[model samples]
Target chain A: MPPAASPVPCKPLFFDLALNHIGFPSLDHKLPVKGAEAASPASAGEANKPDQPGGLSGLVKGLWGWGSKK
Target chain B: MAHNIKNVRIQAAYAELKKLIDQGSYSRIIKTTNKIVNDDQSQPEAWQCKVVAYIQLDQFKEAINAINKAPNRQQMQFELAYSQYRLNKVAAAIDTLDSAPDKDSPRGKELRAQILYRLEQHSECYTVYRELLRTTADDMDMERTTNMAAVQVHRVELGQCPVPS
Candidate 1:
């Protein structure tokens, strides 16, 4: 039987390289909780008052919020 | 905290894949995204990235496989149609969109418009493009304009439109 070709090495996924995409800068950082800021109209004085949802749910919720009126 | 890290990791991985795609490093993208898929096959974005990488590599069969791995097949229909289109399976691409229940979906309609244009169905293609321009996002402006112009030229050549009397 013929020998198979050597498998190519997997390049390490890098953050800076990944951040080259236009959308990634926001994705790399904290995403504000949807509607949290709007729900508290009086919190204009506070610098960071959001009760943010973190991680996948937050991202999904953010995208869902963009897609639908809520 | 755990969920936050997880999402960030996934997003970073996805972003890396997108970057590699933009760099035209399809093989590297496939290798890396396959690792992500192996860790968690449920990530739709990962599967989508893989599908696009495979398409860029002209690996249509693998692109189809990657899309099939996605949880929501309906959501990935546009990508599937695109892979089929690249494979010169235009009718199959049209059928893929047609079979989806959301006939009015912007993605389906836009892709169908492109396919219709490819099939030289200029009138129907133009109507689809116009509807898309009215209904879709601003990002679609370039595509809609290009398709509409192509339709106009095709119509003029066929004597379907008056050349301004």
Candidate 2:
């Protein structure tokens, strides 16, 4: 099977918080790459999340502190 | 909207504590710090959240409910005994340890002795600490094992009386 074409190129952004010390534990514990991967859309059905309050949007918003889009 | 009390800011601490404890990170001990602050966060799961928060901060209470919520047997017994000790209740701590399902586990024995020491039951602590030293069993954490053994010696020696000059 042919692979799907990329819609957009990805890039990583880095922030330098030179003065922060607690950032170490905060980053290590909170940025959950594990849960994010498990919750990928391609593998999970859409309907499954409806029962979960605001659903996936709520989860993502909660995980990364992403506020509701304007 | 009656968004109620399920705000992310409210639960963020709990979510953090759960992850930290699961990974054995940093031992965020908080069981006995702010009793009044906790008695005031009126919300669902408030007590559980308070107990967990306090456990992370090392401000442990009697931990009756906290013990029930412990994710595993060892942690549950440890918290239960520790809470009892904080309340100046030693017999209850011993009872809790005696009833633990895995009494033979070194951590379990360590916990029981720690409780005795907290109760100022130094002789018992000395005896149990000696017993733990003899186990010499293998586990993934050799460093932690050695440290716990050393803690027993440190406590016993510290508890000893000074001779009159």
DockQ of each: 0.02, 0.02
- Taking all chains together, each candidate's TM-score versus the true structure is 0.56, 0.39
lDDT of 1 by residue, A1-70 (tens): 9899898634222111101111111222322333365467566534353465458887887789888975
| C-alpha positional error of residue B41 in candidate 2 after TM-score superposition, expressed in Å | 18
**Candidate 2 — which residues are off by over 4 angstroms?**
A1-70, B1-52, B68-75, B118-122, B136-165
lDDT of 1 by residue, B1-165 (tens): 977676666656766766676677878877867776776778665666666667666788888987786785666676677778767798998888777665566666766777887788989988988887888666547746765876777777789886655
The TM-score of predicted model 1 comes to 0.56
Best candidate according to TM-score: 1
Model 2 chain B poorest 10 in a row by lDDT: B28-37
Per DockQ, the best of the predicted structures is 1
TM-score of chain B of 2: 0.47
lDDT, candidate 2, B56-128, per-residue tens: 4555563466546444435355456556655667788788768867565666666666566556565666676
